[model samples]
Target: MSLALDIFTVVMVVAGLFFFYAGSIGMLRFPTVESRLHALTKADNLSVGFIALGVMPQMAEATDALKLLLAWALILFSSAAASQLIAIAARRNRRRDP
Candidate 1:
């Protein structure tokens, strides 16, 4: 049981890290601001969720796990809001420039 939990944690964490790496690559490789923002937000959001889930099993207490999940939820909301704002600004700028 312990080994299974450990393996699950490791797999989730690795998946999260992979998404983070992919997001970074997208940020660098994407040609347009909208595309880059889309990639980054999507990947990062998933990465955070995965990492939070991975860490939850390692927590010693239920409250601790709940707290971690709450944090992840907050991050999701904030990131979504932030990404929307950025996208709006990018669109506005594009309109103004052209």
Candidate 2:
């Protein structure tokens, strides 16, 4: 059982890291602001989820796990809001420039 949990945690952490790397690549390679934003937000959100899930199982107490979940939720909400705002601004700027 312990070994299984450890393996699960490792797998999830690796998955999270992969997403992070993918997101960075997308950010650098994407042609447009909107596309880059889309890729970054999607990948980052998934990475955060995977990392949280990976860490939750290793937590010693229920409260600690709950706290981690709460933190994850906050990150999701904040990132979504920020992405929306950034997209809106980019749209406005594009309109003004052209």
Candidate 3:
């Protein structure tokens, strides 16, 4: 069970990194700020979330697992809020300029 879990966790981390890469590429190549924001927000949320969730299972103790979960929650909340703020800012800028 532990071995399988380890493999799964590794895979999740790798997937997260893949998302990060995709987001980076999209941000670089996309023509518009809104399109880039879409890639950045979606990819970052999924990548960080999956990676954090994977860490919870690999923790050595229940307390550690709880801590990991809490950390993950905090990250999720902050990232979501930040993304919203960025989106709002983008919209405001677009309205002002367009």
Candidate 4:
């Protein structure tokens, strides 16, 4: 039912937040840029994705669902591309340094 859906959404959001926090801690504790990036990518993409998916079913209408889906898609695409670019830049810098 709707109540069950709401509870699920809330749980998903909380789980996502936990992941984000975990990632933040990992990034801070990590010794290298690459390690930090790994933490960042894991946290950013998955947390956002989990949260978005959680909210998807609660959307009010078809248009609202579409909008949410579009937003999720944008986040997914951009995060992946940005992560790749960051990796490339980091690798390039390492190459230049040694």
- For this target, which candidate reaches the highest TM-score against the unseen true structure? 2
lDDT value, residue 81 of candidate 2 = 97
CA lDDT of each candidate? Answer: 0.94, 0.94, 0.84, 0.86
TM-score of 4: 0.86
**lDDT score of model 3?**
0.84
lDDT of 4 by residue, 5-98 (tens): 9999999889889989988998899998888988988787788877887898898887886787788789878887888898899889999996
lDDT of 2 at 52: 94
Q: Taking the tens digit of each residue's C-alpha lDDT, what string does model 2 give over 1-98?
A: 98999999999999999999999999999999989998899999999999999989899998999999999899999999999999999999999997
Model 3 TM: 0.80
Q: Model 1 Cα RMSD, Å?
A: 0.8
Candidate ranking under TM-score, highest first, comes to 2, 1, 4, 3
Flag regions of model 1 displaced more than 4 Å: none
User: What lDDT score goes with residue 19 in model 2?
Assistant: 98
How many pairs in model 2 have backbone atoms within 3 A of each other, for residues 3 or more apart or on separate chains, i.e. clashes?
0
Question: Model 4: residues >4 Å from true position, as ranges?
Answer: none
Q: How many residue pairs clash in each candidate?
A: 0, 0, 0, 0
Off by over 4 Å in 3: none
Worst 10 residues of 4 by lDDT: 60-69
lDDT tens digits, residues 1-98, model 1? 98899999999999999999999999999999889988899999999999999989999999999999999999989998998999999899989997
